[model samples]
Target chain A: MEHTQEEIRKHVKIYISVFAALAALTVITVAVSYLDLPLAGAIALALIIATVKASLVAAFFMHLISEKQIIFWILLLTFAFFLVLLFIPAMTS
Target chain B: MSDMIRYISKPHPVTGVTNAKLGIWCFLASEVMLFGALFSAYILLRTGATEWPVGADLLNVPLATVNTLILIASSVTIVMSWASLAMKDLSRFRIYMGLTILLACAFLVVKGFEYGAKFEHHHFPNSSTFYAIYYTLTGLHGLHIVGGIVVNLYLLFPGSAMWQTEPERFLGRIECAGLYWHFVDLVWIFLFPVLYLL
Candidate 1:
């Protein structure tokens, strides 16, 4: 799809802001890792921060926020299967 | 025949996206499962083991942090390249795309040094379960970065002529590449904290 110059400029600004946010979050993740929290708590917190960062990249950089429904469905299915994959360990344990 | 051409050249009626776009998303979906399975295996091995080494104690945290930044920067540059093209500025597109490739190379180089250090210290993949997982995860990720660089390089070089002939399709191709690159960066975002910090 053709983008107007204004839209392109807006996207560039968003990209810059997202980059800055990601960098800040990276620092936070590193600092928090050194806090000596319980292992599970640390892993959960780290994954939570990483998820937020991943969401920013996916939503803004990948343009998934405005993506078509078919792609969303595809992702939804993927997420379902991915959860199943993760749960395999729990099932056996 | 016309349907095939339309499938490639125009957006689908149902999806409002091109076939290539849809195909890439599906491919990426499978990739998510692939990596997910590996990560699940990592969890199983870690929990089941009698003793597990802390990640930070074994891996080069400082170098990995730098590589993370480089990958993140590359993600921005790739998106910026697409934005430049969206503005119909081919020159700026080239500059941004060039920077993206350079940053990709920089990440791989740092990764190479990290691997070299591991080998020098006799920390091969078979050294320990942690090392095995470390090498497997990062090596696969490095290969993905290389794959992205190869595509970006083609677009920045010989494949760029499409911009003059079919600017819209060319832009779409770059957008797809940017999506893949961003996904690569996203994987590393998780990998960094999981493998290096946690």
Candidate 2:
């Protein structure tokens, strides 16, 4: 379906909100780093935070949530490639 | 208006142009694994160091931090470029995409300076395995940045009217490229502490 001009404007609003949230998350993650948390804890917290931020960007900004099944299959193939990467290192290590 | 849409709904998939995005994304996924292993190496080496190079003592964190922020800013610009295209503003699309490319070049220039400064201080990869992985990972990432800049330039030139005409197809390309760029930034986010801050 063709997007109405109003719908496009709404998307821009959502885009701005996602951008603001991502920026805030970056700042908060940096701030949290200064708390002297355990190394594992700090890293875990940062990864969790980054994952959430990336997800928002992916789902909305990248529109992955509305993508075609073929696109999803392509992404899955990429994920499978990542698994191969893990195996190479696992063997080498 | 609704009747206009009923006559022609979906456009045909533009052959390899559609595949181009998936191709880029696949290559990037492989890159993540490559960098992931190197980062894991960094972790192992960091723990093994008898005296971990005090971050403040060995490298210039301030410079690296600026580069990090530069990359993050570029990420936003890249997305904005894609957004402009989606809004069917080709001129705005060109402007933002060009700015993104410039910022990417700036990122590399800063990195080049960092490498030069390190070499001047005899901070070669042989300094330790830590430095080894450090240079290797960042160096590889640097090359990827160069590759990305070239891709963006290719997309911007007048010759790519196919991309210009059907901006949705180009949107997919930009989205894929942005993912790689953000991953580059994400790698740096982790690298900052491991290399400069911690």
- Computed on C-alpha atoms, the DockQ of candidate 2 is 0.27
| lDDT (tens digit, per residue) of candidate 1 on B1-198 | 545556565798878889889888888898898899999999898888899988999888989899989999999999999999988899999999999999999999999999999899999999999999998999899999999999999999999999989888899899889989998998999899999998
The candidate 1 chain A region of ten consecutive residues with least summed lDDT is A1-10
Q: Give the distance in Å from residue B92's predicted Cα in candidate 2 to where it truly belongs.
A: 0.4
**Candidate 2 chain B — worst ten consecutive residues by lDDT sum?**
B3-12
Candidate 1 on A1-93: residue-level lDDT in tens? 767899888989999999999999998999998899999999999999999999999999999988888899999999999999999997897
Clashes of each: 0, 0
Pick by DockQ: which candidate is best? 1
In candidate 2, which residue pairs get closer than 3 Å at backbone N, Cα or C atoms, i.e. clash? none
Model 2 misplaced stretches (Cα beyond 4 Å): A1-7, A70-93, B1-17, B47-51, B54-57, B163-172
